[model samples]
Target: MPQATFQVDQEIYREKISTAIIRHNYPFMFVEHEGIRDLHSFLNPTVKPITRNTAKSDVLKLYKRERDKLKHVIESIPSRICLTSDLWSSIATDGYLALTAHYVDENWILQKKILSFHHMPPPHSGPILVEKRHLSLTDTLFCGGEFFHVRCGAHILNLIVQAGLKVIDEAVNKIRESVKYVRVSEGRKIKFAECIAQLSLSCSKKVCQDVPTRWNYTYLMIDGALMYRRAFDQLQLIDVHFKTCPSDDEWVKVENIAKFLKPFYDITTLFSGFHYPTANLYFHGVWKIQMLIKEEIRNSCDAISSMAKQMKEKFDKYWECYSVVLSFAIILDPRYKLQFVEFCFKKLYPATYVDRVKFIRDKLYMLFEEYMCLSSISTSNQSSVACASGGDNIGDEMDEFDIYESQHYGLTRNKSQLDLFLEEQKFDRKQDLDILTYWKANKLRYLELALMARDILSIPITTVASESAFSIGSQILNKYRSSIVPKNAEALLCTRDWLYEKGNIKFSNEDEEDEELAEDFESIITTLKNSSNDSHSSFS
Candidate 1:
């Protein structure tokens, strides 16, 4: 039997040899042994120095060729799909955004990563949103021939966050500060880690050791912090919670720190109800969030009717209970009583309530204004266009009524105008993406580009896919593996199709072959027995 080499170098070399044989069959016939040397001789008879331009050209050619294959795979996929994307900064501080394409197989099981691509990072808020918009547009353009781009729920979650960054920042900061109080010092952190470890032991899982200042399991972290009331009290009890040499005033705040964590506790409770299947509890939670918003608006509005005032307080108290859920709720439709809802919510259960209520209020006002403007425009457009020449006509009557309504409410503005004061507190909306019109426009070109490139580039549809490739690349690029040429990497990637064909090749012998081997073994056993008997006869 011929020896089979299973090492990476041999496998890579074999691929080079095979490709060369297929490309120049005549040259392969001349070689005594089919190997890398023989293939290299066919490609280049003389020893030629490799140049930077040559290397780049080779990589680009390989990339383009492999990418086209990936594109074919993506186009062949026939089903609804989802797109996943992520952004990471490399050692060079260069932004790398990866997009993944997902779809369901014919069997109705989830199939992922038919395509993927690396994108340039957005440096600032405006550019980030712009980049996000462009990606969406580009994806739609690519899939225009077939398959509407499916919205990745994860990406949608990011979009929702981008839409509400202003309000989110304050809440995020307070959460961060509270987290810092636990992590910044060794004693406090050690104690906190101990408390976490204890709980994790009880649950038989690793404890989260994420930085306190960041949003590490925002809800759960907050929940854990609140749960350890005794630990916090003990820390405060010993005055060891703060830095070793802390000011008197800082120490006092540390004592009452438990009270500051109340909002987080309230939030956790509200979010928990969603995880369960109790319908009544869910409805009650929604009512609670609604009432909180209504009540705050009443207190701020001077001309609140008795009925409105009664409804306002009803919302305020209940809204406090669900303050956490409201914090991250998507502001999809703005015209829906946001003024009263936010007013009551901020008043009742503001996270970092003291400094953030005003800020949250400002964000709500802007969202409300934008929503109302869009709704008004949509409604007006549905009606017949108002003519400039309108004398005693239907359009004229409508105009007269509108002016009269405006006059009746004039002399002073309403609750909407009062909310405008909150607007004086600047909350930048230009930061972060808002896909408010994404669905309506059906823009999915960026996703399609990613999908197409997956087949064309022979890459996956997400950062995860790229990550998988890079992991292979890393193994190949290691010191021990460094001798691997980039050409080999390209060849390995291109020949990945071989992996799919592995199941088709047979490894074990067939039934008849096994029977024949068994017969031969039996004959050998008989011969051994006869030899042993003959030796025994000679000894006798």
Candidate 2:
């Protein structure tokens, strides 16, 4: 095709190209490829295809623009933000912390933003990590972070499951060995398949090995091996070398353990979701996990009983006494108010159920008072206050909806909103309730307690959001792109997320970039390496 005289805006087109490179996680030099350059030239004879340096500059510019835009959105938010953190190491022996923020905006929609991909050196201890972030963002944290340090539900479940899995170690080893043997050679695989065919085994599953560290994969390995037991038994009779097949008794033990792990696997998948699962939604998942552990603790099988005890210790260490924040999250759910809270605690700690429930109730009331004080100052200008008392709008749309004064809302001035919330009958649990929508629709009703719900609901159930941010690490920090400066690298990763927020990029696992570390920030801060304090880089 002949070249055409295309009068394209040079800088504008360069930015579009730069956005594509970062959004798709392409290397800056991708634009420098001969084919890319030639294609641009053919399409626009007046076009100036960017060199690698130009691509880098354009990416940084885009990053700064988006960072400022997100910063303003964050600063203007009326409710507190929840955060999740992840620390990562690069091939260059560099450390980066990825910070992500989850919050309900003024419009009452849940939002997640990557605030920073900061560079930090080694010695990433608990205190050091805390201090590094507080150096700049301590003020933005909720209530001085007394309720911060929310553990990832999925990670704790993994730990508990791994501890319990110790009882099945012997059975798992035998299955692992048999799978390795079958997979070691093509001949062995074919022989195993023949054994399945000849034995007329109904199982469609092929035996596979697990990574050992991951309990879910281990569950799959054992689950599949148990199904193909007939084939393994047949192989043992036919092949002299297939001596590692699990015994019938061992298979029976494996089956019991798989049953024990099935609920945990389900919960992990639930909590690890990127978009949907919230802290409020996790009460049932965690309650079911606690019950399952208690159920197995009394099992007739010694191995299963012993495994449950081991897991109980881990669970007690992390969850039994440490789920105050999570409990608060569940209490905020309109479907399960104080009654469900009492029910959950009564089931777990029967003897002290009353006291435990009292403790949570008192703490919630105290937290609500703090929010009440904060809201008094922030709500002075709220036009909703005018509309509630049958007054005119203060330069905004207003409505006289006095539910509090009406008997329908059970309005009482002596009782606080938290008390009133507890007294009201729980919303129908069977009904579909978008909790955010519920709170937003009733914002004029409960007022400050509704603000607390905004933050509590935004609390992440898992670190999966931050972890998913690293899914693109393999594509970004490869040998070819490893030399990209830390400043540019942070810019690229931050912009991909910023682009996703703007509807310019799809936030799919198939394409993304990995930055250094994790954790959410109050603002969209893509902090640069402390060593290179470039002024134009706004988030730093």
Candidate 3:
């Protein structure tokens, strides 16, 4: 009998290897690693080792194939999409632009997809950015790009908090220095642990140093230091060189500042959240944030009051008034509707609330009419192309309003869909309603208005989605990811996101380079060795 030989399907092997690379964000050179090759050979001698070049080619092919499928999906979906664009500059001065789309799918599930991850080579300026985006995506844009240029709400909130943090900088710096000093060496950390033990301090936390540019880290730095207060005080007594320990008075200020910042931190998390519909929540989030800052401005504590005044100044600078898109979003939300808009508008604009509310309501009606007219034109265009029963030429010669009035809504439809929506009793404020689900359930009742809701509700309150893409890009574009060409760079990033879309990618802004823990004090003290266990995991 002839010996039977086993053959490996090289095509399937290469594709699966390419997929693993993208899904796990492994470097392309991962295929060429000696251990990887050895493992593959031992598993099946028939399989051949592939080079990084082959891996790169495989990745590009996969990207192009999958991208076409996603494009088809986007076209078939009935919901109009909302986009977010973000720019990231690498350590090597390379600029990457990530554009993402958010919309409700046919099944009423909210979907977010990456549209482009382009390698932008340039002097990164507003005009250069605008020109590039215009040339590339102009034809595909919805509403003719009228509401496209949305500022990231989370980024603006960061600016406001960053400006506020400046007021308490002196106190923050002192606590920050103390954290840095202790984490410098294992000896210092051991000694610091002794101080905690000596004081019988029950705080199980360790001090965390802040990345000064990220306010969240500053908040964490303050929060953690506050826990180890007595230990830090104890460290000051023996670690004579640790002169940056905050004064008693300064400590009070730090405590108060952290207390004041807690709500801001929570609000940011709420705004930056990706899984839920944020557009409907946008109005309420900002309203609470502004309300908190306004109250703090009149705080009994002089330091807090002073800090809030500066924050308020910055807040007003950016959010003198809200956007029409945001206003439209909340109006579509059942929990708020036009009634809540009326209430909030009065608070936002006491003198001009009536006119402002009317202005927004009129715009909503006009927007619905725009959607109505477009729906008619689309039907007419399709009919003309298909040579349908009527062979209607009305779309070309008829005014758009005429199409809306004659076909969709006429005089008797007074108390328009918008009016009917507003007249209905609003959902109770305490109801736990997901806005997308609410609109999806009611989609048929108000046909044109539901189209508006589908688009408006899917709008992202923050550019955090694109920013998260940058975090993944930061890993892929780094030194250890091998020499990825610009085209391959986009392919790797975009493919990773598409392949792993089920598990949401979260990149925490926390600084882990200053880690001083992940060790048993008893063993590390005896061995005098460095230890680390956190795997740099992200929340799913």
Candidate 4:
């Protein structure tokens, strides 16, 4: 007998190597790592470690395999999907565009996928972005027509609040500068810590720096600094160099501004949720924002009123273009539907309430009719098959009559799906009531109407999902890893998300070990500090 030779499994080997590259955001040259080569050598003496070029090829192959799997999933699904896209500039001054798709699968689970994350060369104008998207999505199974483009609601809220923030820029600058002054050096940090200890303040949270691009960071910085007000006061008394301490009136203004901005912050956070449907929740938030603006505009304080005026201008500028799709989305929610929309819109736009309500109702009906036509064609084809099979031709004819009656009466006499859904008692369960669950349960009952709901409900209220992809891109393509070609970076970023979604990846035990080490180090430092204090007391 010939001696049997042991052969390495190329597929498994390639998978293990690809996993390393994705999990750690490793460079393609990672195969050249001494430990990696040695481990491969130990596993298979006959197999050679892959070179950088070969590793890159394997990574691309893995990416294509994963991309094909996702494409199959998107194609297999029968519902429309919503897309959110955003442009980001990397540390290397490279501009990249990210597109994410949102949908509710048949299991009633909310699903988000990063459809594309790739470089968008210079002159990133609107038309250029649109053209880039058309190209990127061309090969994917998803049809562009089925997708509705939604601007990120959180980003829009940021813009609105930033407009209001401009009203108190000088005050915010002072607070920010004061925070930077305290955090700039170790001596200042020590001095500030001493002041906190002396004041006996319960807060252990340190002052934080604010990034100008994110208004919420400013909120957090001011909120944190306000907690150490007395400490700062103490610092001002002893430190001659503490020139940036906010004055009493400035502190008061900061407090008022924070208070005024709290609702916007809360709404932004609420809308940024990834695990649930936000479309149905948008109307209530927008209504609350409108009410808040009105209330603030009539405030007794001149400063707040002026700020509200600026915010209101920005809010109207964007929201006036609020797509009818948003209204349709809310109407599909059984809990709200057309009645709730009418009531809210009447209160919101009292002057043009009649016209707006009529417009929404008409648009919703038109949408329903469109879906009904599609359902009719599908039902007719199935019925024709049943008739040909000789199961029950008479029954099939009767079923057609029922569908015709439903459509004719439902449309001409206000007995349609919209009316039926609206007239039925609204779903009373509010807490943890899954909107997708309700739709799934009632899909058969409403038939074509349910199909329409699924498509519209899948539409996200914001582009935050795409913005989050940019965040991941930033981490993957940081300054230290600037040499990562855009193609590899895209593969790494998207694969990471796909693997996470599929539950094929998890945080390593090393993270837990590091956390434990940190805790142990902190405890040791505390012990040393107590020992030093005790020694000083004994000496005294």
Task: Write model 1 residue lDDT over 140-179, tens digit each, in one string.
Answer: 4322222222222222222222232222333334333545
Q: Per-model C-alpha lDDT, please?
A: 0.37, 0.76, 0.78, 0.75
Off by over 4 Å in 4: 1-10, 39-47, 130-148, 204-206, 274-277, 384-414, 480-483, 501-540
CA shift at 281, candidate 1, in angstroms?
Answer: 20
The TM-score, computed over Cα atoms with residue i paired to residue i, of candidate 2 is: 0.82
Model 1 gets an lDDT of 0.37
**Whole-model lDDT, candidate 2?**
0.76
User: Which runs of model 1 end up more than 4 angstroms from their true locations?
Assistant: 1-9, 12-69, 80-91, 95-97, 114-116, 119-216, 240-540
Off by over 4 Å in 2: 132-144, 190-208, 379-411, 501-540
Query: Model 4, range 421-507, lDDT digits (tens) per residue?
Result: 878887763756677778899888888887777877777887766776766676788888887888988988888888764421123
TM-score of each: 0.33, 0.82, 0.84, 0.84
Task: Select the stronger candidate by TM-score from 2 and 4.
Answer: 4
Give the runs in model 3 whose Cα sits over 4 Å from its true position.
Answer: 1-6, 130-145, 198-206, 274-277, 378-413, 508-540
